[model samples]
Target: MSQDPPRIVIAGAGHAGGSAAAFLRQYGWKGAIVLVGEEPNAPYQRPPLSKAWLKGEATAESLALRPARFYAQQTIELRLGTRVGALDRTARQVTLSDGAVLGYDRLILALGARPRALPLPGAELAGVKALRGIADADALQAALGPGRRLAVIGGGYIGLEVAASARALGAEAVVIEREARVLARVAGHTLSAFLAAQHWAHGVEILTDAQVAAIEGEAGAARAVLLADGRRIPCDAVLVGIGAVPNSELAEAAGLDCAGGIVVDLAARSSDPAIYAIGDCTHRPLPLYGRSGRLESVPNAIEQAKQAAADICGRPPPSPEVPWFWSDQFDLRLQMAGLAFAAHEVVVRGTPDAPGFAVFHLDAEHRVLAVEAVNAPADFMAGRLLVAKQARVPPATLRDTTQPLRGITI
Candidate 1:
């Protein structure tokens, strides 16, 4: 008698988990694949939730990473709208919230993160929202329109993007950031200033170094934001885009090593060899930076998915790519490559006042550490390569506009 095929059970069917299922089959996994998700809908693109999707530029169907038929065609079983209640590591089984249990030979955990709550008084008010999924986006969209006021309680990419979208919808927006400047944590000073100016030019008020004390609500809805300095800014709604908290509780319960997120190696393998973790839930190895951290981006999720698939299929590992991220706010397209943790020098490739520009961060030895490109695709591409190769280039060579960026890599 022939033996039954091994079963691979994937928890949390978000972008990372969905992609892992597809890649597993493509990379030669002759096993039973089961993808389980908490969301009722199929996997969809999330970056556009604050930009194109909010602006009514993209449809629900368009956001689908893969059509519903694709899963069936691939013989991949999708168990949507159900949670992975418990993991039995010893038995290699997972109990679902719907009272179903699945036994697996291998497991992949892609439990993504949730939007961090405001933690202010009235944060639970009806009109105070956080954009993390389709439901949140829909609620926010309904609250925005002409003559409405939106008080954003963060200066990060999601907050800024939503503020821009509100402005486009003819709503008044005020961004309240506790930091000294917008994008302070993720971007360089130059990029921060430029983005701040852009939002200001678009008529979105930006408050830097301003801390929010509490959210004041009228009846059951958020009506205004109270500042720490006793300033009250009235608004029709509030959006708290402070950050995200990784959903690693399940992994932790399963006895997986976790810190900030589920700790995983380059192959997305957790402490347990039979189980792996990926996406925002994993504190993954960043080989380019000689460090490990949780990266909450689509690119990072896809990259880790590929890593897990290759490892499971016993194929040659894929080359490590430089970490990259992008944001679309107002008329700006910001693409960044690598991390700028210990940079010692900053170089400007183009004039900031111009239509396009790039900021390059370099270490003491002038090695390309990171690049922030504003509507500069060529610079982003070249910078990504330089970061991956860890190439050291002179500051003057990078600043020279006459030389081609790709050719100056030497």
Candidate 2:
């Protein structure tokens, strides 16, 4: 109770909420910050929910982004398990489900996203589970055991990770995808091909172009899944990794501009300057991507929250941080710097068959657009700088294993 410095109300205590609170404190904004979340627990890392947590390789304590002491030490008030029922933009207040009305000078919505489910029949069967929150991960984990059969729906990151984890636990894992290949939408053909090989090496059964008709169960317990291809696969549990839709219903109901997600400006402020949204819940126009887009990645969450915090604290904007992301599957550590689309030309600097290699993408102007590195942090770091400076690396040397990737300079 340090005299309640400039009241701020933050909704949805996910990664964005935690990051914004931490940033505010780091920037010396000694204001009263109230982080309100519908979930009973403080903000924890959700990416692990589908990976290590599902495999029981990580625990609730380890998954926590920041400790409970973090908020306590910073004097940031956290109201957990409290749902924000209503928001009045004019009155600058939020009405909690508990019937508590809170007034704020500024508001930040970091509500994040929700997993999308299929509309087919029997979607409510006991085996049907979406991998998003902690509770969902716990339920899925409980179903994993020796000889257990897991039919993982969708061939995205979550499904593949879960499949691997289940296999490690001695469970028969089957991945059924509606697409021709796994992760066709997110990664390029090369990465997808690599991952498919890795999963195959681990003895995971993958069914591509598979359309599941229904989940068959007995006595309200999961038994098997019926596919549209007239194939039935027995299973003890089903993990749906189709995709996620941003949690923008509250903003949409409140009449905020929402396209793919709640539309925000470069500053992370919504159409209404007093209100701001960050993380997966925002379709912010990114100059780096050349247009407005919504990216569902941790890098976007952390960076956008920083921008929102700076704006709230009345500080001049910081430099636009170059976007970066990583994914871990088995022993391969994949890192990406900058954004790359199909138009970009991809050339391998190191041999693809090598234990460690880098794939560099360049534009027509010979400027580095992006780079994907496997177990190559130096290449990743250099790629980050190249994207930031829009630098050029000689085409032959970029692919030459003779020179260190960091030495790749124009």
Tell me the tens digit of each residue's lDDT in model 1 across 238-286: 9999999999999999889999999999999999999999999999888
**Each prediction's RMSD to truth:** 1.5, 2.2
RMSD of 2: 2.2
Best by TM-score: 1
Relative to the unseen true structure, what is the C-alpha lDDT of residue 363 in candidate 1, on a scale of 0 to 100? 99
Ten-residue region with minimum lDDT total, candidate 1: 1-10
Give residue 318's error in model 2 in angstroms.
Answer: 2.2
What would the TM-scores of all predictions be? Answer: 0.98, 0.95
lDDT of each candidate versus the true structure = 0.92, 0.83
Consecutive 10-residue window with the lowest summed lDDT within model 2: 1-10
Residue clash pairs of candidate 1: none
